[model samples]
Target: MAKKKTNEPKTLKPEIAVGVLGSGSFATAIVKMLVENSKTVHWCVRNEFVKGAIELRHHNPTYLTSVSFAPKSIKVTTDINELVSQCEIIVLATPSIYLSDQMEKMTCEYRDKIFVSAIKGIVPKANDVVAHYLRDNFEIGFRNQAVIAGPCHAEEVAMERLSYLTIATVEDEVSEKLCQLFSSSFIKVEPSKDILGNEYSAILKNIYAIGAGIAGGLGYGDNFTAVFVSNAIREMEIFLEAIYEAPRDVNESAYLGDLLVTAYSLFSRNRNLGNLIGKGYTVKSAIQSMNMIAEGYYAADSIYRTSKEKGMKTPIIDTIYGILYEEKNAEKQFKKLTAKLT
Candidate 1:
């Protein structure tokens, strides 16, 4: 069932040291948000070059270069162990594929801290969502975890465009406190308790975005694209219900709004991957051409595997999985897909 929200005031934790564990675009955006309400953030970066750039230039050299930081707003490091030890709230913002390797160095002490998952993809090897992966590996409890999700993109946040984020957690106090850290004049925060629903929605939207890109590459008109997206949302609602069995509406920003933006936005890497495939690039060639990780590529296998195990019928996911993993001809598979959509 959808949880009810009351008019009670949000509780803010004072002097909470928040640490971020990524150097990507989204991680930079998150740091930008947190620093507004914080004096210092403990950030761990894998690349020593990125660490140097942020320390010396106060700007991320690779990702969001235009977004600058203040003189002492961030405390950057290469040590994950050190970062987690200093902060009470640990935000995991690394790409899903690299998460296991990046966090292998950290100690188990972080299991007691509040974990916020900013990765939109599942952990590839384990086929588990970030929260679930952490719970199993690090022994972190669900109440200690929260996820930041929505239609908001890292590029938009870097531009200081008005954006909204949904922070999902099991505890109201966890959500309430984390919202204070993420809220800014340009950034608004919404709290949700539907962690699984929100996380799965984020993962699924990337796959559908790839479908959108493929359609564009194949010379499908806007009329066809519009219909494709409409059917995609209904499919998303069904997938969510089958997986989580919740009474929540999938039309909210965390679900439908997120799916819309990722599927059509120019900044979508998942769509970019699909576009390359649709343009006759081999899957390997298309992936190699992209500068960033396309979460959809890694998530397709996991979500598809899970769906089959549960005996649920998800045509869009199945089609995308067939094209991506099975190396089925994109044109031929999409032609079949076109017949399935309403």
Candidate 2:
């Protein structure tokens, strides 16, 4: 069940110190945003070479090398505890699969700090969203938790292209402060109170994007792709409503806009994974080939289990799960899925 929103407001300072945990493309992009508004940003990068490169070269060596940073404005460290102790807010951008392991390494208590999940998938074994995971394990209350959702992509952020980010928290002050930290000339931040809805929408969209890629790889043209995505949004609405009944517009950018971009954008890693699978690569081979994580690959199973337990009807999720996890033929599953979609 979703936690009830509290009437008690949380306090946020004007000058906020931010820390980001993760060294991926999105993490690099987020650090870039922080540097624009912050004097110094604390970042946790476990990789020695990546840490050395960022400190010495003023750029991430592995991801998003094109976007350079002022080395003096950022503090790169190998210790999660050190970073956590130094910063007021910690943005968790690590892959959801690795979230547990990463949290286990934290020597400091996270209960007092604000945690924002930039990760969009459920934690693997726990089957809980990032917010719930923190709440259950670390006693981080919903009041102190927030989520960053996007119809936006890290690649576009790296290019300094215009993008929209939805920052969701039950506390208005927390959302506003995060918006101030992240908003730039090109990056527009919108505040939302629907944290769970937006987080689930963000997770569900990647699964739909994989379905879109499967269709594209199977030679289904724009006409079919359009129908697939339209039905996908409806399915996402049903799933979100079933899980957490909120007065949210599924048509909002955080929900519908996010689904559209992930399903159609060239930068979508989930779509790329499905495309490879559709073109005859086995799931193992497809996963092996990509350097970045295709979140949907992990999210599919988690969504499938949760929706099943909830007794919700999610045809799009079911179909994608069958193709990706059940090893069902992609062509056959999509054909069956077409009949279910309007």
Candidate 3:
């Protein structure tokens, strides 16, 4: 069963320090959002070079260039130890593949702070989501000051378009506090207690986005695309049942909203990667052509490996894996998948 929202109000502030774990577009956009709202943010980059670029240029020239920033007003740090110690809220915005390595360098003192994960991918090595890593490695709890920020795009922040996010946590107090802490003029925040379904829905939708792109790449029209997304929802329903109660909101904004945008938007690396696969390009060529990170490629292996280990049937995930890494042709794989359902 799902938990209900409480009506208690708490202190909302404009000056809380937020620490982000990556120098990527999403991280930069998050920091920009907080700063625009009058909160201070400290972004953690790997080296002095990326750190210098963001600090000096006021823009992430490498990852999110179109969006300019004036974060000279905030702090930027390269040291992970120093970052975790200073912030009230810690945001993990790194890719899923780099999460374990990043976690190894941080201390458990962050257990007292609130954790907000802006990443959305399944880790292949550990077969776990970003929140699971924080909980298992740092000993964080489900109901204790942890939340998942899902289906938010960094590019939209560059346009200053009004965007919405679902901050999922089990603790009522933490959820209520975060909804205010992260809310801003251009960024609206929605709170939910179903942390489990929120993250899973976000991850699984990316996999489906790749599938949708592959369909588009194959010259499939709106009729086929309609069937594709509908079946994908059924796929999501089966997958979400394993871990969480059905969240209608998950299918509404964060889940389906992200699915449509990423599947069709030119800004989506996952869709671009899928288009390359449909065009007979190898995974190496696809990734090399693009300079951004596509969570679906890494997540494909994670879902495949973990689902196999857990004995879960994920046909869409399996078909995507086959096209990218298994040397299966896209047309052949599509027919195979269609045959199974028919």
- Cα lDDT computed for each candidate against the true fold: 0.89, 0.89, 0.75
Which segments of model 3 are wrong by more than 4 Å?
A: 1-14, 246-250, 309-311
| Model 1, global lDDT | 0.89
Worst 10 residues of 2 by lDDT: 5-14
Model 3: lDDT equals: 0.75
Instruction: Give the per-residue lDDT of model 1 (tens digit) for 17-52.
Output: 899999999999899888888888889987788899
Per-candidate count of clashing residue pairs (backbone under 3 Å): 0, 0, 0
Give the higher-TM-score candidate: 1 or 3.
1
* Per-model TM values vs. the true structure: 0.95, 0.95, 0.90
Best by lDDT: 2
Regions more than 4 Å wrong, model 2: 1-14
Q: Tens-digit lDDT track for model 2 on 1-342?
A: 988966533233356989999998888889988887888899998678889988889999988889998878899997899889998899998888877888898888667788999999989868888888888888888999999997888889999999999999998878878987998888899889998999999999999999899899888999999999998998899999998999999998899999999999999999999999888788889899999999998999999999999999999899989988898998888888888888
Pick out the ten consecutive residues of candidate 3 with the lowest summed lDDT: 5-14
